[model samples]
Target: MAEVDTEINGYIVPKNSQIFVNKWTIGRDSNIWSNPDSFDPERFLKREIDIRGQGFDLIPSGSGKRMCPGFPLATRMVPLMVETMIHNFNWKPKKGMKPEEVDVSEKFGVALQKAVPLKAIPIKL
Candidate 1:
């Protein structure tokens, strides 16, 4: 809800009116992203982009004053955890399945989750 009345793109938005920002639409807009539907983390490495809300293209943790307080901790912890897991174990697909057979389809809702739960056999190093 907006605390004060504001004009946005020629429309007068009244105070206390609920505004829904469609982040999903923005994320997949063809005008903004090339091959928008594809998962490509390497694109970030190729481009000079910031994720801490500074770059409008990607704001996973959000941006500005309303951004998440735990963004810093999450960014650090998530990578560390992933690195540690990869380093400590050898992961293989369960039931003699090949790595390529794993389903990466997403079940989208309030949060995006794997359509099929992934089962992996972890061999400790």
Candidate 2:
């Protein structure tokens, strides 16, 4: 809530007014991320931002002051889960489809979900 009448980015915000931030828009903001709509996990390796560890809550689970109770377990498990999968198998798109042709479109609502369920075949190593 706003503490007093103030303007933010030119819009007047009255005191006591409740405020909500749209994390979806912020996550896709071109100014904040290049090729924001594209899936690029490598983007994170390119820059340093204080968006974790109670600094800023952005992305899955939680961080910092608003950190989730399961953070400790999740931090250890999620990575192991990912690494285990990558280590054991090679993921491939459905037969007859090109990698670039796979749909990565998302349906935005309360939470973002893939428009189409991703169908990939996992080949055992």
Give me the candidate number with maximum lDDT: 1
1-125 per-residue lDDT for model 1 (tens digits): 56788898999999978566666777778998889877776867777877788877777777888688999899899999999999999999998898777776767677456989999999999
What is the Cα-based TM-score of model 2? 0.62
Cα lDDT for residue 28, model 1?
78
Model 2 C-alpha lDDT versus the unseen true structure: 0.74
Off by over 4 Å in 2: 1-19, 53-59, 62-67, 111-125
Give, for candidate 2, the lowest lDDT window spanning 10 residues: 54-63
Residue pairs with backbone atoms closer than 3 Å in model 1 (clashes): none
In candidate 2, what are the lDDT values of residues 1-125, reduced to their tens digit?
A: 55679888999989987565566676787877889888888988887765445434244544545556777788789889999999999999999999989999878666356989999999999
**C-alpha TM-scores of all predictions:** 0.70, 0.62
